[model samples]
Target: MPFVDIRLAGNATREQKAAIVADVTRSLVERLGKPPAAVQVVISEVSTENYGAGGQLVADRAPVPKMGEDANAAVTSR
Candidate 1:
């Protein structure tokens, strides 16, 4: 049996997660000769507020738009 663990700083769509699981299982099956049913995969999504880097939380690293400001403008200007 093989165990795989994946952690993401943000969320993923259901379809994206499903594809990831399928791809990981396929890889283990092909590379390690493990049966698909014997392979285990776990996906964890950590909120930006809960994850930190460079002495700051991920949520705080991105600029939030002020009132009446365009959200895209804040991201592109950075």
Candidate 2:
């Protein structure tokens, strides 16, 4: 059996999670010769407020944008 544990510091839609699980299971089946039913995948979504890096909480590091602000602009500018 192959166990895959994934932790994300944010949320994902149901469809997204399902896709991830399917992809992970397929990978295990193909690479490790594990049966699909024997592969286990656990997805955990941790709150940004509870997840930290670089001595700061993720929520604090990536604050929500104010109204009318383009969120992608910051990433593009960087």
Best by lDDT: 1
| Worst 10-residue lDDT window, candidate 1 | 57-66
Backbone clashes in model 2, listed as residue pairs: none
TM-score of each: 0.78, 0.80
Candidate 1's displacement at residue 76, Å, is 2.0
Top TM-score: which candidate number?
2
Off by over 4 Å in 2: 63-72, 75-78
The alpha-carbon lDDT assigned to residue 53 of candidate 1 equals: 92
Candidates' C-alpha lDDT:
0.94, 0.88
Model 1 misplaced stretches (Cα beyond 4 Å): 63-74
Error of 1 at 45 (Å): 0.7
In angstroms, how far off is 46's CA in candidate 2?
0.2
Q: Report the CA-based lDDT of candidate 2 relative to the real structure.
A: 0.88
